[model samples]
Target: MSRGYNGTEYFRNAPGLLSVRLKTRLMWDGRLDGADLPTAVRDMVTEAHFMNADGRLIQERIRQIPELLALWREAFGAQSQPYGPQIFVAIAEFLKTLDGGDTWWTAPCAATR
Candidate 1:
């Protein structure tokens, strides 16, 4: 006989709750694909991933946390003293000035274009 509504089944567990205790961790050996940002910056990004991560960083399964690019944008965007907004305005104007609206330029450094 089954105690049908006793709710003692593992299969009836709450969604996303089962994986909640399974922490995801991240580990990196510090490799950089681009020459512009420097090793330190790249390493900082990787370290941030681990530092901001939970104990399960080795599993590398965190939610949508910001990546390096997003981090840069957010960090820069939040700055005051007119530098960030000034540069932002200049870039917006510059992008508007583009003829083709696209360029095959290396990011974080436009000189490579």
Candidate 2:
């Protein structure tokens, strides 16, 4: 069932990640309730056609970075450091900052006035 990277309509605009938080479901089929960003990030990383990476593997790799480990500790106060779920949380938080610049498409048009 893996779609395998086709480089065709595979990626969405990064800024759209912010808007997805308002969605009731995640993924194209809209099966995931609440569209939870952490859950979506975890699924994307582990899904075969996407990152295809094990959560444990990602955690191990991230732990090797001293700066990131420190930031994780400061952010979450985790004594053990770099908990697997923290990675997803961090990614979700970062995506929240991707609010796209205000453009005509995002502005209120005269029709609404």
Candidate 3:
């Protein structure tokens, strides 16, 4: 389990057995950090679908998906490629999948209304 600065439980029901860096970033973006990545991902995906599709953030988000995050954690933790460029193309491909509609890939959990 992890708690946000506000003491809001970002992730629970799972113990600390496997709280990898990727999970931290995902929950940070999608749930805890107030980064609004899910909203940003959705917006950028829409723009890329119908517009220039060559923005820095859009490209960055592509690189920040789950698979790449996992790859980075493993590679970095193992002292492999210290920097991350191998993930760029893959992330771009992922962004390509975000064509206009809402992508469930990084959708935030529905806030309590």
Error of 2 at 22 (Å): 1.1
Please give the CA lDDT of all the candidate structures: 0.32, 0.71, 0.42
The local lDDT score (0 to 100) that residue 64 gets in candidate 1 is 32
Displacement of the residue 30 alpha carbon in candidate 1, Å: 35
Which residue pairs show collisions in model 3? none
**CA lDDT, candidate 3, residue 28:** 29
Error of 1 at 24 (Å): 40
- Candidate 3 lDDT over residue span 1-113, tens digit each: 54533455544343332212223343323543323334333443343232324345544653567675467667556443323233444343454454444345456765522
**Alpha-carbon deviation at 26 in model 1, angstroms:** 32
Better of 1 and 2 by TM-score: 2
What TM-score quantifies how close candidate 2 is to the native fold? 0.69
Worst 10-residue lDDT window for candidate 3 reads 14-23
Against the true structure, what is each candidate's TM-score?
Answer: 0.18, 0.69, 0.19
> Relative to the unseen true structure, what is the C-alpha lDDT of residue 12 in candidate 3, on a scale of 0 to 100?
38
lDDT of 1 by residue, 1-113 (tens): 21112333322222221222122321132243322222222232334332232223422321134463354456456432223233334433443343432346525677766
Q: Which of 1 and 2 is the better model by lDDT?
A: 2
Off by over 4 Å in 3: 1-83, 101-113
